[model samples]
Target: MAEESGGHATTLGVRVEAARREAAGVTSYVLTAPDGAELPRWSPGAHVDVHLPSGTVRQYSLCGDPADRRSYRIAVLEQPAGRGGSVEVHRELRPGAAVQIGLPRSNFELVPARRYVFVAGGIGITPVLPMIRQVAASGIEWELVYGARTHGHFAFLGELAAHGDRVRTVPQDTAGVIDLDKLARGAAGAAVFCCGPAPLMDALVDAMAAAGHAGQVHLERFGPVATPVRDAAADDASGPEFVVELTRSGITVPVPRDVSVLDAVRGAGVDIPSSCEMGICGTCETTVLEGEVDHRDDLYTEAERATCGAMLVCVSRACGRKLVLDA
Candidate 1:
């Protein structure tokens, strides 16, 4: 087994034990800690940061049973327009390849509720799948509404089908669009967990809200939306670089224009916990001890953004060229 790192450390070295093709363009990787040791135990909805070549690091959720401590399993869809991370993992990474992984983090966790409803679209099933499995294993009442562009694009159909009546697959080509109104009706006291394309999530949120089920909804975003061009006046070229003090480590890192505060801190080997690398997952959220953050993520609500004191590190720049983080 690989040497176990200290308790809940931010980063650890792991090795690829195996990789196999799962579908047309998806592959699953089995990662084991160094020396083939047991990996850190993680819960449902947890994800890890995968360091790919070209310095492109991406996050993928653990798709297998969290109780299985021997290794972690992650499935990757080779997006055509990807920044070469998934493709490189599929083509170049081989067994025994070493990679750095961040500790498991989760914002889309399952909360205790009377019942559960899971909605997944295409690759978004990566996180929702394990949650469904855990709910099923625990004998909790749950149902899955999975959608894909086509039947061929759907993963885990066999397992889902084996569940008989509990899971429903909606292929867009065959089933048209998912009827959120029907799905949300009579769903009171049931927590709804959804992960899918933004449009689908938006529809679900709107439909649930109209059906009076908004309070039971939870979502996770996988990427960032394109930001509009900032007004010229908002650009301050004369602003001086600010210092971000890490509260836990007592380290101060300079936030330069060329690099984000996240990059500066990570460059110093201080793991601030991030994923998506795109301001979406809210994984690298840290409290603001001082300074304003030009919040850039779409995940947090306006009120939550103001009250949480947390900021997404992927694309959010410091409002004053420097921001203090509770690292």
Candidate 2:
């Protein structure tokens, strides 16, 4: 898809050429340019922002092959308790429907590794599917532990069959939950990629640490992660207010405990593009010029956080009294 003339806010017009049921409560949509043209080149873990007819936007991982640019594919799991993104897609989006979408963006990039271990839960399998294909083509040894509520809920079993015994399916109804302890036992040297429900990711992270492979794992979250809530008494005792200096704009904004740096900076008449304001999208990442940041985002790796030069301004707060940002 060609980038339009809307400055950096360009959106591609795509038609839903095909929609198929992948599994129970899950459906895959194939999007292509209205004229049947190749779209943008994207990596394995990339996702596109889908703009619904109702004006509600949501991000869905590209599950199709990265080698094929003629179409962009995404799988949506009907989320009844969600804020209506999935409901709109499952109910109203159909073949021949036109929708606007952003270019592919990736926060969960598959880093080079000698070997890999992938874990997917439910619809979280979307992003991992592409990564497995890439890794297999590269001749790297890899394994996948895929789990769903039941065998009926599993998708992509036919594609995974080519991987042979490297893929393990654990349906909760029959096989019970996945055993992270056993899965992480000998996975120390391989890069581990996981995308799933928050609880599964949390358990895997903790399990990896217990198994002496903490730094070997990477994760992509489907929604906002749970951040620690600072107690009112503790925050007040430590002087909760902080100063945010927008270096490029040459403005000093006082960020009270109740206001986020993103809101405070924007209040000073500076525009910062933000999506998923809860800090999951990595859209509001800002360079840190000074001060300590209490990084609260799950987007950054340990090494990225240790360097401490960039932070997601949406949920990240100041650890010191002042923070200088290249905004």
Candidate 3:
């Protein structure tokens, strides 16, 4: 199926069946159809865009079992300093409250491997939890290195304990930070999936590279890897406007210096599935039929970027005066 688009008109309405505090400042919401009908099926490492009443949308991982079609579960960590989405989720998402959500989307997909090594930090475990369950049930050799600020900050401890020594719980206050080199060494010759804070993500990539485990490392970043969004002043000083030709839509949109390719096309009534406009999520990725792109997203790998096959319209721009997108 294609990515969810066409704005709220295409959104699915769900009622919050239950809301439980999983950990310190973190809550998990179980959403189901009002009539208790079966919902869509999703795999591990999948997330949904939650549309709040305040018009704010946030992408959250589906941590619940994929086989359970009765409902979808998503966990949210309250961020006091964030851009208000989490705050609204914490305050307004109560049991029986109606909510809208986009269909499940996955970028951090689980590949078939002889063994899997999962690394997570704090709330990063949301996506990895279901993955762990799926692999564990298969009797495959898999392990998890999960860390948080403290033991009390860790969610699903009771569940993780079922895996015994296969799960390594490291509370920074007592265990110190996870050793990247040690982790890389242990995960060599195995498929490694990591999702966490920027520090851990950056260090693990380097460590994995040094240990000659480059192709086996799969990471899902919370935000941009390097390039932050340009400021208004920076945007003003950016290159001239560019034209984007959408082949499928058969429309030509003008992308102004201060505007993104996403805003430009959406302004022209071209709806695209997008959540994090900051270039973190892969929702706005568009095929590039023709164009020199200024790729700015963390979603694509180095090999993928070298091919110039796709571009994240939310933040990436054209390298020249024109671009042809599949849309």
Off by over 4 Å in 3: 1-10, 228-240, 246-252, 266-271, 287-289, 302-309, 325-327
The lDDT per prediction is: 0.80, 0.89, 0.88
Q: What is candidate 2's TM-score against the reference?
A: 0.86
lDDT of 2 by residue, 1-327 (tens): 445543664579999999999899999999999998889899999998887898777889999999888999999999899888899999887999999998899988999999999999999999999999999998999999999999999988888999999999999999999999988897979999999999999999999999999999989897776767768887766556899898888989999888989998889899776667777887778999998888888787678898959999988888879999998
Q: Give the poorly placed runs of model 1, Cα more than 4 Å off.
A: 1-8, 225-275, 282-287, 299-310, 317-322, 325-327
What TM-scores do the predictions have? 0.81, 0.86, 0.88
lDDT, candidate 3, equals 0.88
lDDT of 2 at 316: 88
RMSD of each: 3.9, 3.0, 3.7
Error of 2 at 230 (Å): 2.0
Who is ahead in TM-score, 2 or 3? 3
Deviation from native of the Cα of residue 116 in model 2, angstroms: 2.0
lDDT of 1 by residue, 169-219 (tens): 899998987888899995788999998888888889888999988999998
lDDT of 3 by residue, 1-327 (tens): 123444433568899999999999899999998888888889999999998998878899999999999999999999999999999999999998998888888889999999999999999999999999999999999999998999889998888999999999899999999888998988867899998888888898999999988888888778877756567665444444889999999999999887999999999999876789988887788899997888788787778898859898998998788999997
- Indicate which candidate wins on lDDT: 2
